[model samples]
Target: MTPVPGDNPTPRPAADAPGAPAPGTAQPAAAGGPLRTGRPKPWHVLWLLLLLGWTVSAADRSVTGPVVTWMIDNGVGFMAHADHPHALGGLIGGLFFAGYMLTQFPGGYLGDRYGHRTMVVVSLLWAGLATILTGFLGGLIAFIVVRVATGLGEGAFYSNDRTLITDNTPPKDRSFGMGVCISGLAIGITIATIFTPNFIDFGRSVLSDIEAWRMAFWVLGAATLVVSLAVTWFFRTHLKAATVGKAALHLGAYAVVSLALIMAVYLIGDSTGLSDLWIAVLEVALAVGLVLFVLVRKGEEVGPVLKDRDLFIIYLCNIAILWNLWFFSFWSVSIVAGAAHSSFAASALTAGFNAGAGIIGFPAGGWLSDYGLRRGWGRKEMMLTFTGVQAVLTVAFAWYLSAADHPSLWVMGLLLFFASLFFNALQPVGHALTAELARPDLRGSAFGMQNLIGETGAVLAPAVGGALRDSTGGWTAAVWLDAGLVVVGFVLLAQVRGRRAVSPV
Candidate 1:
């Protein structure tokens, strides 16, 4: 076969050099096992529902990052401090990820053991409550608590969603399915960044001050709840009717534990006259305890996936990638604000431009991945090409932005469009590669583990970016720093050769 010049480099993974078909097509589930063959099932339904859920997930989680700026500008929430705006902003941004970070493994375990339907239902409900409360709880303490809760709720959701998509899709459409499902993030971010300010202003026209922001949360939160129920109904009506009973048991257990933690925190805070520090500690303890409990139950089950060195490399690469992605996602509004000296609307519009690129890029990436596979190309090759090249361009973007003095909104938008186009293309391939490598039963756990490690970037990016800007006096240093991380991530990704090397399945 002639070499495909663009995606396939000569030094390709030796495994795929032979008979491997690109994933999402038919092949052996294991050596000499029954062929895992099915035409793409009615995948549209699952994609739409998951996309709806993910969009809400993205909007709910992303709302705070941009709004943190508004808080700083208005002297609300953590932004009450005039002295450390960057640090405060970073802290606020990081807190959500901190909450998100803790739940990766445990949530994955539950989703794998219990069910994806259960996980999605629980996550959406958790996100809705937290998002709604985040608006109502205006203080710094309340802000952190609720935002962290929102993140925790949102965590593990993607892993489970990925596993489910894999379950539904055949090998051929896998990348496209993932692209379609995950594009929700791009769309949700677009909605939050581009229209949310307008939504807030609309709320203010009816009710002024904090109510505007709060109303934004309220509306999104309510929508999240509605979507959760819709997903529950859809998944229940279709896939996992038997697990419904078991899911109720899981929810009950969660409710009981959550109530106990709430009571413990209240008692400790009230009786001891301890600061909110103790309460925070108790909350953390509860989270850790829950994770430990889940690990104990299925802790041993996660070992095989955990032991895979290549998988670990993939996780680290994901962390590196996310570090930059989240750094940009969480701080782009502010970065634009600073560079263009633009209003929130202008900043959001710039973000919208980047996200808009993602909306197209995500699907295109999947399609391209599939297209390469049909030509007998490899997923790893595509991943290496797309992610590696994008990583370099990201650094260049940072360098160019850092050097600019008062860049125009269009200039910022134009640069971001290309940078984001590459960045978004990486998603489908990375996610598809992950699904292809792991054992079927363990896909959820594998995804959870990778994301668990990966979210470290999410946890740090905001704070790191903020700290860098706070210290260096500009976003250039911060962007450069993240750019370096992405380069390192690409190095890690380079080490992650596919285990099967070539799976036609």
Candidate 2:
């Protein structure tokens, strides 16, 4: 195989080849001369575009967190209404996921079939338009519709970006590249935290407080639009040609597995009352189906589906970490705010968690993963070590939170910061492992499956945490229960096998 300019070096079948590259094997370079030593590759340009797209998508999604309270204060219909704050809040928040989950597979398929750049541009433009419209909407139904639309548009960005990076980047550099892209998520959220308040305040002074929310949305939409245009204009060059024949087989397998899981969940829901245990079991089953689908459909040359010892372990560990992680995202603030004796204290705690996770945790995680990879550590070692550390810290934090004597805000904030650190670090490591385990042709679907599985935590965390809190009249038991899940995840991860040292490029 020969490396061609603007051609993918990863092994796959030729455009006219009889069979696809065997699973797990890198697609072979095109039949041409070796890459010229002096010329710049197109990957650098694509990288910049990816970074821009990721930052914008992340910022668009995260901006809601900081601004939700303000929106409520400013007469945002559903959030401000007294009828059902909890239910309405949950509905508004979950709408994003609802839109997001619906588009995952379609996005992956389109990126594989059409071109990542096209999807990236389309998704960004569509979401940006919807976000701007969200500010202008007058009624609750309108807001929900716009938010859902934004979610649907934004859903494709992450998967498409991952596909772009995987297709263009060299295998040895894949993890680090992924880390760079993932870091954009943190960067966007951090920017929102620091700047959104000021933006809101400015809009209020210039117009009205209610109008400020509108202004924020409009401004965010405009900024995203500009970035998207720039990326599309500069990075619209042709993709490196690479065979993607295996995508069909992988998609077929995923569809079969996904349908089975959905049917099983429906049957279980019908057979049993929506008991807490049944719901939890259903969530776990869905997650397992997703993981198995991705693992099983991986190309044969890459490796056996379940036989790769380390891959399976990494999957379990990731599921555990993500379950706790999602719980923190969805309910931690609500719980802490409810528990704190004072509104001020509760608000502070909520802010601390967001800041810790968004500002500090994400970068720290990426840095640690990159460091471990550079130092010749295999992904399994890095993931397991971090998983254990995260579990211990989480358990200690839960215990502290459970105590009747409340700790000082400063102490609580510190603990929350460390927890976020652990949670954020898990992402890059998990992604690196997934990339390592999957065949190149299946990268997009692989990530889709990972996210789909990880999102099951989203479904479970709220339902389970809500039930526990409702039954116990406190969050103590809920937090402790999450800690136990972490432990279980760690035990499963301990079984994964991989090279002790990083494999050479």
Candidate 3:
């Protein structure tokens, strides 16, 4: 590829090169030659584009969560029976992830082949349109179809956006860049919490007949369109080409496994009996299949592993981190509301937890990760330490919740703040691990796999929490179960060992 007319063409050593200097280390210049500095060329424009794309993607996906109850209230109900609302809701909501998981490998491969920028722009526009359609339509079939389309569009956006950041940033700074970009995810969710209620209120006040929930969708769609245009305008250049063969194989394999598992579950459950045990077995099988699919794809030699065992351990810690983070998003509000002595207090607690995490914890995590990288501490170590502390805090909070008759809101809030802090810190560490392990050509696939694994927690947490709560008779059991999972995740991290070779900033 020809360099742009004024752009420098001088090739620098790749950050993951055998003996690349650590972030803070200085390289000696050649005798009488200008010093070979390590600072990265500014990519502010690209970073902003990445952030905009990510924020829109995340907002579109999560906005449904806050507005589902409103949708049900406004006569667009999922089912006639109250008993089946959760089951139907789960099925409807899970469809988006089903589509998302289905498309990830293909999206990653497409980004590698066609260019990350191209796939991102296309995905943004596609999802924006689908989101708009979702607002205008009603009924179960329409909801399901539009959700699937939104999933496909969003699946493409996440995979390609990660690839773009990985391709554009130097290795040493990749984690920091990724952290900054994904912080948009946290920001979007936060904005939804703050703004969605007000938007709904405005719609209700102005237009008595129109469902405010529908209006929220319209507004979200408009915002998505604007962001999509911004991304297209700013990220016009294709920096790295894609690889089609590997992406196709990986994508095909996942699709086959997912379809087979879903079919198997349906057939077995619908057959002789619909025992809880049989349903449980089917869910476990589906989960296993998903994991195996990722393992097989990752094992295909698409990327290089950091020689250090510790780096791999760090990755494990990140998986744990993601598990806890998602667990809270799925269950924290429900638990609080269920336990709240008063309905108003419960509402306030839920709002406070989200506000604190989104506003304070997310940015802090990125800042700390960047600080560690700049100071020459291993990013992996930072992740491990933070997650380990999180596990302890979670256990303590669970115990408190279990034992207390009327826990103080202030105390609960403090624990939640700490949990959010540790949870958010893991993002940069995960990104750094990918940067350390992936070869430049395969970075997209590597990051895609990381995201796939991390998000599996999203799929499992709600189901697991619900089951535990049902079996044990309250939210306390669910909290303990989550705490235990976090600890087990820490143990997994303990197995990773080795130091990564530092890359240039």
Candidate 4:
């Protein structure tokens, strides 16, 4: 693939190369040399700003759990008086992931073909607008559809963000940069868990409980828009030049097709009263069809990305990671509240402990991976260790919940915090490994394809976990199932021989 002028991949430099500083610290100039000081480097600027982007994106998605929980408790909005309320709520999350899953590869392809910066900017704008729309739209169907649209827009972010960071940072610090940028994910989750309920309560003072959650969405959406403008301004000089006509012909067309596919599943299920399981299966079928279509149209280009067995393993392992991730992200508040018999505010705070772990876990894991490389270890080892540890913690948490009539809230918080530390750590380690495994030029598509396959787990986890919870009448079964899947992911990852050495620029 031909590189766009401003988005060409930067060659990775070897760690031992002179002038390379340790992962996070700045290098001092030679002894008696003048101090090197001025504006922050471009990579630093991108990393910091991208952290904000990830924060808002996370805040937008993480708000769902608190809002959904509020609805269920207050007997308001979509979950009010619904049979199998958890199932309905989970399905909403599942549908969002379905749209997110379908767009992964195509979004990455567009990022690679045009420019990562352009797609990154586009995604933020699209997500911000769609999120704001959700605040204004009423009813279940409207809410679901708008959330799906938001998912589609946000899907472009991961692949491009990873690619962009990898291109800008040296290989030594690449993982750390990616981790720091994504640390916002944990922060966003923390913010949502602790503050979203507050936002709703604040909204309640002026509006009905049914409509109060809209205020949370509106606040997050506006924050996202503000970040978009900041990014556009900061990246003005580096953005790829594209005509309005070209954008319409390419991105516009892609958006229309992707939305149509997602909506088709929603419409079919709605009209037929199909089970959530069947709806998810149908969405997976559509996703598979979309991939097959892409392969047929661009076989030669797509073939290289698909041919790696290890990459496929990594992709599959991510299914477990994401499954466990959204399972908690979508339901942790409810899980905590139900198990501990605590108030929504207290439960959210406890769950926030889990999400907050990521703030430390993400960067710590990345730094550890980088440190491991220097000591002859690899990203695979870091991922395997964290996955195994988290699996144990998950099972323990599940057991505690099942054994106690009212699980101790403090114990629950501690378990979640430790488990999530490992869980969140695995993310940056996995991304670093994926980048190491992929060719530089194809990194965008590779990351996209990774998420496209991994998100199958995301699509199924929420609805399936919810179904299990509803059927079993407790979160114990759902939590155990989550633990089992992560173990499966660990086994899959053990088969991967991730390359640790980088070719010097």
Order of candidates by lDDT, top first?
4, 1, 2, 3
Relative to the true structure, candidate 2 reaches a TM of: 0.73
- Model 2 error, position 398 (Å): 2.4
Where does candidate 3 clash, by residue pair? Answer: 112-242, 112-243, 113-242, 113-243, 309-497, 309-498, 310-497, 310-498
Number of the top candidate by TM-score? Answer: 4
Candidate 1: residue 402 lDDT (0-100): 69
Overall lDDT per candidate, in order of appearance? 0.71, 0.59, 0.58, 0.81
TM-scores for candidates 1 onward, in order: 0.83, 0.73, 0.77, 0.91
Candidate 2 regions off by >4 Å?
1-45, 71-76, 239-326, 330-376, 404-406, 459-478, 498-502
Question: Residues 112-173, candidate 1, lDDT per residue (tens digit)?
Answer: 77766577777887888879888787676677667766777788588888877776566767
State model 2's lDDT.
0.59
lDDT of 2 at 147: 71
Write candidate 3's Cα lDDT for 1-505 as tens digits: 2222111233343222323332212221211123237632433345566777777777777666556534433444454443434334434444555556556656666666655666677777877887888887767667766775676567766766765555555454566666677777766665654466666777687655445566767788889999987766554343222332344344445445554554456446747666333453454456556546555765555434323354445444544555465455544554665555444324434544643464455455656766776776766677678778878888888988878898766677778777766766666666666655566566566555555545555555544555555556667876787788788887776665534444344
Error of 3 at 160 (Å): 2.9
lDDT of 4: 0.81
| Worst lDDT 10-window in candidate 4 | 23-32
**Which digits, one per residue and each the tens of the lDDT, describe model 4 over residues 1-505?**
2212222223222211223332222321211123247634445667888899899998887787788778888888878888888888888888888888877898788877766777788888888888889988878888988888888888888898988777666567778878899999899888988999889988889888679989999989999999988987766654545632353257657767877888888788868998776787788788888878888999998777787899989988988988988889889999999898899999999998899999999999888878787777877888899999999999899889888876898999999999999999889988988988887677889999999988888888888888888888888899988988988888888999887664322
